[model samples]
Target: MGEWRDVFDIKRDSAPVEEIAARIDADSTVKGANLVILIMAIFIASVGLNMNSVAVIIGAMLISPLMGGIVATGYGMATYDMHFIKKSLVKLSFQVVFALLTAAVYFSLTPITTPSPEMLARTAPTAWDVIIALCGGIAGAIGNTRQEKSNVIPGVAIATALMPPLCTAGYGIAAHSFHFFGGALYLFFINCFFITFSSFLIFKILRVPVCGGVSEAHFRYQRWFLIVCGLVVTVPSLYMAYVTANENIRDSQVKSFISQDMDLEASSVVAYELDHGVLIVDVIGAPLDDQEIERLQASLHQYGQLRQTTLKVVQGPASQLNQEQVQEIINARLANELKNDSGKSYKELANQYYGSYKRDAADQNLLRSLNRQAPVLFPAVRQISGGTLSTLNGEEETEGRQWLAYIVVSRQLTADEAGRLQQWIQTQADMPVVVNIQLQDTPSQFYGNGIDWNP
Candidate 1:
C-alpha cells in the first residue's frame, strides 16, 4: 500500500497553487487577444463544418480558447475562490455568446445551405461523448497543474471539441432549423458541464489549497453544493447517453440481421431509419411479400434491443423499369406499328405512328416547349430527348406515367445547375421528371510549333 501510494502520488510533479492560479488568471478574463482568438476559432470551426473538412475543423480546435474559461471556472470552484469563480463564469458566458453570435453571422452570410456530415455528426450526443469530455477534463486539469506542461492541453482541446458544437448550433439558428439547434446546443452543454465537473474533481483530489481562510464547516458545505450541481448536470446526460447507446445497439442489430438473413439477390436494403420503437427499411430490386416480411420481423426478436420494435418495409422508388427497359418497350411498339401500316396515307401514317405509341398531343406539346426552352436555359445543350414510361408499382406497371429526359451537353453541368434544371422541368410539367445529362467532349487544339494545349 505504501509503495502504491508513492507511485500514484499526483503531488510529486504538481506545480504550486500560486503558479497554476496565475496561469489561468489571464485565461479567465475574456478580453483583448483572448476574445479575438475565441471569435476566430468560432469562424474557423463554422467554415470547416460548412465545407465538411475534417482537417480544417481540427485546425480550428487547436487554437480554440474556449477550454480556458471552462478550466478556470472548474479551478475556482475547486479552491472555493468566490472572486475567481465569479470572474471565470462571467468570462465563460461572454465567450459562449460571442462565439455563437460570430458563428451565426458567418453562416447567415454564406450561400451554402446544405448540411455536411461534419456538422451533422456534432448534433447527436451519446453517452460516449460525456465519457470522453470527462476523461479529457481530468487530463486537462492534470496537465495544467504540472511543473512542466506538455502538449496535453492542446490534445485535450482537440479531443473535447469545444468549438464545433457551438458553431453547429449557430448554423441551426442561422438556417432556422430548430432540430439542429437543439441537438447541437445539447451536445455543447454536455461538454461544458462534464469538462468543468471533471476538472473540479481532479483539482480536489490533488489537494489544492483554497484561496481564503474559511472554517471547515463552510468549506464542507461549498464542496457538497458543487457536488450537487455536478449531479444535477449529470442526470440528464446519463439518461441521454443510455438512450443513445440503446439506439446504436438497435441499429447494429438491424444491420446484422439484414446482412445475415436477407436474400441479397432478390432484394437489398437501400436505407433505414429508426424512430419510436419503429424501424423503417427501404429496399430495392425485389419486393418482400407479407409472409417473408413477417418472418423477418420475427427474426428481429433474437436481438434483445429490438425485441419490441416494429419493422416497416417500404419499396424504393427506383425499383421501376430503368432506361433500357423503357427504350425496349418503345422499340417493340414502334416495330409493331410499322409492320401494320400497309395501306395508310402520309398524314394517316403520321397519325397512326403517333397514336400507336404512347406519345399523346400533350406530350408532343411538352416536348416542343422543352426543346424551345432548352437552348435558352442551357446554351451548352446540343440536343435533348425525352419520353414517358409507365409507372411500376410492385409487380405491375400501371397507367400512371413518369417523364425521363436525356440531355446532350457541350460541357459537364455542375450539381447545382443540374438540380436547378431538373426542378424547372418538373415544375413546367407539373410532375416529377428524371433528367440525365451527357457531356460532349470538346476536341483538343494542337499547334504545329510543338505546342499542345487543351481547355
Candidate 2:
C-alpha cells in the first residue's frame, strides 16, 4: 500500500501559487492576441472540417484557446475563487460566441455543404467522450501545476477536440439543420462540463489553498450547486450514450441478418429503416417468396434485439418475379435438383434462370434492334444485352433514358471501331446509347488478358 501510494503521489515542485494563478488568469482573458488566436483557430477548424482533412483539424486543435477558459473555471471553482471563476466564465462565454459566429460565417460562405466524416463524428456525444474529457482534464490540470510543463497541454487539446465540435455546430447553424446543431452543441457542452468537473476534482485532490474567505453554509451550498450542475449535464449524456450503443448493435444485427439469412443472388440491401420495433428492409435482387420471408423473420429470433422487431420486406422491381415466372423458376430449379448428374452447379442453374427471366422481361423491340444491329455493326461481337440505366434512387427516366449495351466480343476491337459501332447502334435504335465492350483475347505486349475493352 505504501508503494502504491508513492507511485500515485503528485509532489508539487518549484512552481509558486502566484505564478500558476497569473498564468491561468492570463489564459482566461479573451482579448488582443488571445481573441485573434481564438478566431483563427475556429476558421482553421471550419476549413479542415469542410475539406475533411484530419491533419488540418489537428493543427487547429493545437492552436485552440478554448481549453484555457475551461481550465481556469475548473481551477477557480476548486479553490473557491469566485472572482476568478466569474472572470473565467465571462471570457469563456465570449470565446464560445465568437467562435460559433466565425465558424458559421465561414460555412455560410463556402459552397461545399456536405458533412465530412470529421464533421459528422462530432455531432454525436457518447459515454466515451465523457470519459475522454475527464481523463484529459485531469492530465491537463496536472501539467499546469508542474514547475516545468511538458507537451501534455497540446496532447490534451487534441484528445478533447474542443474546436471541431464548435465548427460542426456552426455548420449546422449555416445549413439550418436543427438536429446537427443541437447534437453538436450538446457534445461541446459535455466536453466543457466534464473537463471543468475533472479539473475541479484534481485541484481539490492536490489540496490547493482557497483564494478568499467564505462561510461554512455558503461553502456547502456552492458544493451542492456544483454537484447538481454536474448531474444535470451527466444524466442526459448517459442516456444519449446508451441510445448510441443500442443503435450500433441494431445496425450490426441488421447487416448480419441481411447477409446471412437473405439468399438472393446478385442482390443488395438498397435501404433499411428501423423505428419503434419495426424494421423495413428494401432489397434489390431476386424476390423472396412468402415462406422464405417468414423463415427469415423467424431466423431473426436468434438476435435478441431483433427478436421483437416486426420485419417488413420490400422487394425492388428489378427482381420482383411474377407468379408465372416464379413458378417456372421453381420448376426449373426442382428439375435441376432431381437430376443430380446435370453437370451444372447450383450457381450456373440460377444464372441460366436469371438470364432467361431477364430476356423475357426485356423490351422486345429494343432487344431486337440491339440483336439485329450489333452484329451488323461489329461482326466480332458474340453476345449483346441492352438495358436502361436507372438512377441510384431506383427511378427510371421517361425522357433521355440512358440505354446501356453490354457486348462481349470474340476478338479485340480498336477504340475507333468501338466508337463507330456505338454510333451505328444509336442511329439504328434511335436512342441515346452507351456501349460497354469486353474482349476475350490472349495476353499480348499491348494488352492484358481478358480486358474490359470500354470505349
Candidate 3:
C-alpha cells in the first residue's frame, strides 16, 4: 500500500528550487527568439483555423511558448515577487497582442472568409474547457518541479490550447463580428485565467521559497483585479452550461419521439430539425395529404419537448425523384443498421429502398390522376388530395392497402351529390375505400377548414 501511495508522491523527484525559479524567469520574457516563434505560431494557427486543419493546429500548439509565460506569471504570484509579476504580465500581454495582431493581418489579407469548423469550435468555451485548463495547468506545474524535465509542458500547451482561441479572436476582428470577437476573447481569457490560477495552487502546494521582489502594493491591486476577472469569466460559463444541458435534453427527447411515436407507415421521414420553436420535417416514400400532415403536426403535442414546437412537413413535388437524394437517405439508414448486420450489402439496401419508392410513386400518381379529374366531375369541388396506407391483421402479415381522401368544395353537397362523388372516387381508385363524407365550414382553401363535394 505504501508503494502504491508513493507513486502519487510529488516530492520524490523534485527539482532544486533554484533551478525551477531560474527556468520560469527565462520563460517569462517575450523577446528575441520567443517573439519570433510567437509570430510564426500565430500565422500557422490562423492558417490552420482558416483551413479547418487539425494537424496544422496541433503542430502550431506544440511550438507555442504562450504556456511558458503563463506558468511564469503563476510562479511570480506564488513567490510574492511583485516586480517579477509586473514584468511577466507586461511580457504576456505584449505576446498576446502581437499574436492577435499577426493573426488578424493574415486573416484580413487572405481571401478565405468562411469560418471553418476549427475556428467555430474555439469560439465557444464551455465548462469542460475550464476543467481541462485546470488539469493541464496542474500537470504542467508538477512537471516543472520534476528533476528530469518531461514532455508534460508541451502536452499541457496542446490541451489548454492557448494559440487557437487568439487566432479565432483575430478572425473575428477581421470579419467585424462582435459575437465572434467577444466569444473567442472570452474563451482565451478562460484558458489564461484557469491555467494561471491552477498553476499557482500547484506551486503553493510545493512550498517553493519566496523570492521577494519590489512593488508589493502593485501585486495586491493586480490580485484583486484578477479575482474580479475570474468571477466575470465564470458566471457566463455557468449560464452557458445550463443552456447546453437544456439543448442536449431537448434533443434526446425529440429523438425518442421520432423513433417511438411517429407513426407514418407509407412514408419515411428523411430529415428533421428543430429551429427555435419550429420543427421542419422532410419526408419521402408515399404521398402525404392534408389529413396526414395535420395528424403529424398534432402528434407533436404528445411529446413534452415538442408540445410548443410548430411542425412543417415538406414533401417533394410529384415529379421524378432525385436518385441522389434517395441514395443519401438510404445510406444514412443502412449506416446504422449495417453496423449490426455486416452481411447486408449496399446494393441490397439500395434495391430495397428503391423498390418501395417505386410502388409508393405509382400510388402517388394514381392520386394525382383522381385530383385532375375532380373539377370536371364536380364543378364545385375545389380540391382533392389523398395518400396510401398499410395495415396488419391479428397475429398475421396481410396486405391491407388503405387510401385516405379529403375533398374540398365551394358549397354544400346533397346526399345524392356526396354518393356520386364517393362512387366516382372508388371507380377511379379501382379499390374499395372507406371515406367519411361530412359538411362543415365551406372550402376556400386546399388543406384547412371548409368543404363540400358538389356544386
Task: Tell me each candidate's TM-score.
Answer: 0.66, 0.69, 0.66
- CA lDDT scores, all candidates in order: 0.76, 0.77, 0.77
> Tens digit of lDDT per residue, candidate 2, span 1-455?
98988777775352677777778788777888988888889989999999999999999999999999999999888888888889899989888888888888999999998777678788778878889999999899888878898899999999999999998999989999887788888889988998998888877887778977878987899889978987887788788899888877876787678668764676655444555687766566766788978887898878977989988887655546553555454455445433422212333434545654564455456778677767776788777767766445436443345667777788778777777878887775566887777664543334323233463
Error of 2 at 296 (Å): 1.2
- Candidate 1: which stretches are off by over 4 Å? 215-217, 264-293, 300-302, 309-320, 323-455
Error of 2 at 313 (Å): 2.9
Name the weakest run of 10 consecutive residues (lDDT summed) in model 3.
Answer: 338-347
Candidates by lDDT, descending order: 2, 3, 1
Pairs with steric clashes in candidate 1: none
Write down the worst ten-residue block by lDDT for model 2: 338-347
For candidate 2, the clash count comes to 0
Q: Mind giving the per-residue lDDT tens digits that candidate 3 earns over 1-455?
A: 99987887787788888998988888775788887888889988998999889999998898888987888889888887767778888889988888888888888999988787677777667888888888998999999889988999889989989999999998888899776788888888888888888888888878888775537676678679778977887888878878767777777766666666565677766555566688766677677888877887787677776689888876674244585676665676556444322213343546756766776776678778877888888887766667666677887775677666677666667758777887888777777664543333543333533323343
Say which prediction, candidate 1 or candidate 3, comes out ahead on TM-score.
3
The number of the candidate with the highest lDDT is: 2
TM-score of the candidate numbered 2?
Answer: 0.69
**Residue range 247-282, candidate 1, lDDT tens digits:** 667667866776686656677654454556787665
Evaluate residue 124 in candidate 1 and report its C-alpha lDDT on the 0 to 100 scale: 71
Candidate number with greatest TM-score: 2
